[model samples]
Target: MATFFGEVLSVFSRAVEDDEEELEESEEDEDILRELEEKRQVRVHWGPALELIPNTDHRLHCPHLLLTVGHNASRFVSVFFLSRGDWDAVGHVSLWNERTLQSEGSACVLYRHRDSHMLMCQVDCFVAEDQLFQWTEQVLSSLEPSQVTVLSDCPAAEYQSAQPLGTAPRLRSIHTSACSEPTCCPPVELPNLVSGLPAAVMSFCQLQNISAVVYQCYSDVRSADSTAMDTFRPAVEQLAHSLNLDLCPDQDVLRKVISQAAVQSNLYI
Candidate 1:
């Protein structure tokens, strides 16, 4: 290239400018990914009740930990135990993902018996697949529980059986080696695997050598109903007795719980 003054100038390739722009774009993409990863990380936040507990390590000490995953299980616990007003709000787990609606302490709530060493956690939100393990780890790492019991819900179609499934919900159980007591239901068959948060909790408990049992309920309905919630009553009778929870809540309480759920799920309202 030459200027008007007749001075020769070097010509620069436009490809170099294009390469620089591509590099900048790549850096920006990396930054966005890092931010998303950070945002997706699962975290546990303890409530003021836990902070006031007189423990040297400031950790929640639980003799028996009960975890309920999915809407049916959570509602079952709510209608049976929580309705009795014997529990105190302890803490919650927070996570962000595409399906997350309320990351602020409402989705996954932890409760403790007002007079006993029992702890219960009800997870009513949709946890992303990738965040399940992290959510399990962070939530359980803060507590020292001798026995862990998980109640999970699934569609009946997921169950692998030669015979046709009945209308009633079915229960299947998977327990860790440390668990000595027999389960109320049969073990989940091979090739029919459990996934999501329930599986993550079971795996973590097995690796940590904690006595744990997971009761998975397979229901025909897509949404939570009274029948599906009542299906777990027989399976959890012994646990309810041990925890001194009301095995059969009043009809008024049951109606209230079911009505509230119906109101929330009503699309036409």
Candidate 2:
């Protein structure tokens, strides 16, 4: 009985989305978009917390937040504005490059944006390594939506390698490489590379200016004997698994993420 209704609703939802897409692409709607990418929250950071810019809309409705998935893709990144407890099927955007996240690590950041009428939240994470990425795919697929939202993979220039936290020391890890560009530099230390989950999230939030965030980290502490790094695929997957097993909080877990975000805001940087 429940399954029957669920299936029916899903079919209807798909039809509506198809209609909306058509309408948006219609000649009349194209003119509307040219006027103002108004509801478009893609590039705009909700705030320092969720990387969402402050509200630019003037609608009076419900309180909700947006989730932006980051990836290597080049097209407009998919962004979703969701209400609290919106575990229903989500969306994914096109990913231009999948190989990017397979190498380094990225921390997820949550942000809170306020306006005269409403408050919103936004979430960010790497596509390849984060468990939420899987959850999103599954949920969106279940909804029978036309496509999933995927953010562009963070390019090499923007990529930051997260190192093993507890196992190795930070200072000793960074070293200079010779015979290169004039700038000639050593490995840059990434705050996201730290071992402690709290520290990583804190660093990510601080870096992105997203006031609130929920992130759990897994660092690869390389061994001194061999000096070669392990493949990032398995390392990142293992860490993501560990984070899910530990019940790490995310925007999906509002009470906890909100509480933690508050604490992070109050922390004495």
Candidate 3:
């Protein structure tokens, strides 16, 4: 190329210009990823009920917190506790990830008893591994619960036993050092480890010196059903007296819950 002054100049090739554009695009993509990560962080939203607490500090003083993770456990809580209509929807936690399918309203909901200091959290959505710790922390930070109980479900195949499996769903438990109540189920065996949100909550409780117990039900059936839900009945009954929860909900409500779950699981629907 020649300039107007008659001086010769070398122009860069199209390939060099294209490489520069690609570099700029790569930088833009990195920015987008960073922004998306920030957006995906786990967040807890408190409802008006919690905000209207009489306490000066406005902190939720939960005497007991019952957390249910996964479809089966959530269904159990739905049928046995929430169906009573004595609890108020006090808050919810929201997070964005590839595995999460439920909307924010239904994913992770917090319900507080109308008259008692007990709170129940039902998590029906999938929480990714990286977000587990953040989810646990954000959910627990608002509440000062004396004791925490976690109910979760997993595939029965994941459980390893030397003998043949039984008819009923197997229950495995893990608890923090501060826990005082005796676990209704046996301790989870080695090599069959607890993971995901339940494990994260347990770890957080342990580190915080909060009394916590996790009851993990291993169901043979792949889908949620009354049978799997029943496995937690004993544990629920044990805690019901102390928590002032209903030991047995109406059979009609139980049927309704199971039917709704069945309809959702149907492929033809």
Candidate 4:
């Protein structure tokens, strides 16, 4: 996401906590339509991506955002609200020509060590080595893409570093004699996900292929029986218009379907 988009996420995340109050304020204006229109902005984007770290014991039931971002030739960003753990994010950047021999020969591998927030991603898909390094620099420059480390090592060698993003919350591990006892397992707390994007967020990711790639990853990793990942297209697209209009229950809808997720393919989009 761009600097403006990140600010928008902060705005919408804060708005989710203030929905009741915002709803109440909207009611006082009498013109419900106009109140909604004031919610539109192009600076923010809200969407979903798979957990880089998967759950081993229980199925998570959070509402993963389900909108698609279309394809484009320019750079754009998608910020995911991680469901495996609250607020831990995994971001994607649409940054390749996607139409070259080198890119065609390229591949990537992703690894997530047990019981850690650390994710090590090694990329192999790129038409040019300079462009690959450039994109890595751009991605690392932002805080939203936190905990990322780029390496120029060959395909055989892997680097290890304890590089943690400054703003991300630390994942606390449980260590005690009770670890081997099944009866003492702690309860799992699922995050209550907010599905629809406020107009601002929709425009931010829709700028390029941001939303499309986001929906692509989540759809690919989503469990077969998980219908909660489904979303209505008209509702998602109207987000920009939703800032001014009411959503109809009968809007024609479409589901985001992606056959590839990085979790399965281990490749950056």
**lDDT at 261, model 1:** 74
Ranking by lDDT: 1, 3, 2, 4
- Please, what are the lDDT tens digits per residue for candidate 3 over residues 1-269? 99999999988799999999999999999999999899789988878756644323555778889999878888888878888888888888888888778887778888988777699999988888889888887778767889899999988887887864576788889999999888887899887899888999999999999999999999877666888888888777766877576667568878887788789789999
Please write out the lDDT profile of model 4 over residues 4-45, one tens digit for every residue.
546533334676768987887878776765654342211111
| Estimated TM-score for each candidate | 0.91, 0.20, 0.90, 0.20
Cα deviation of 7 in candidate 2 (Å)? 88
lDDT of 4 at 44: 14
Give lDDT per model, in order.
Answer: 0.85, 0.28, 0.84, 0.26
On the 0 to 100 scale, the lDDT of residue 53 in model 1 is: 38
Supply the TM-score for candidate 1: 0.91
lDDT of 1 at 172: 87
lDDT for predicted candidate 3 compared with the true structure: 0.84
* Candidate 1, number of clashes: 0
> What's the true lDDT of residue 5 in model 3?
100
Worst 10 residues of 2 by lDDT: 71-80
lDDT of 1 by residue, 1-269 (tens): 88999999998899999999999999999999999999988888777766633223555778889999988898888888888888898788888888888757899888999877688999888889999888887877878899999999999988888876698888889999999988888889877898888889989999999999999999987666889988888778887888776688667877887787788778998
Clash pairs (backbone) in predicted model 1: none
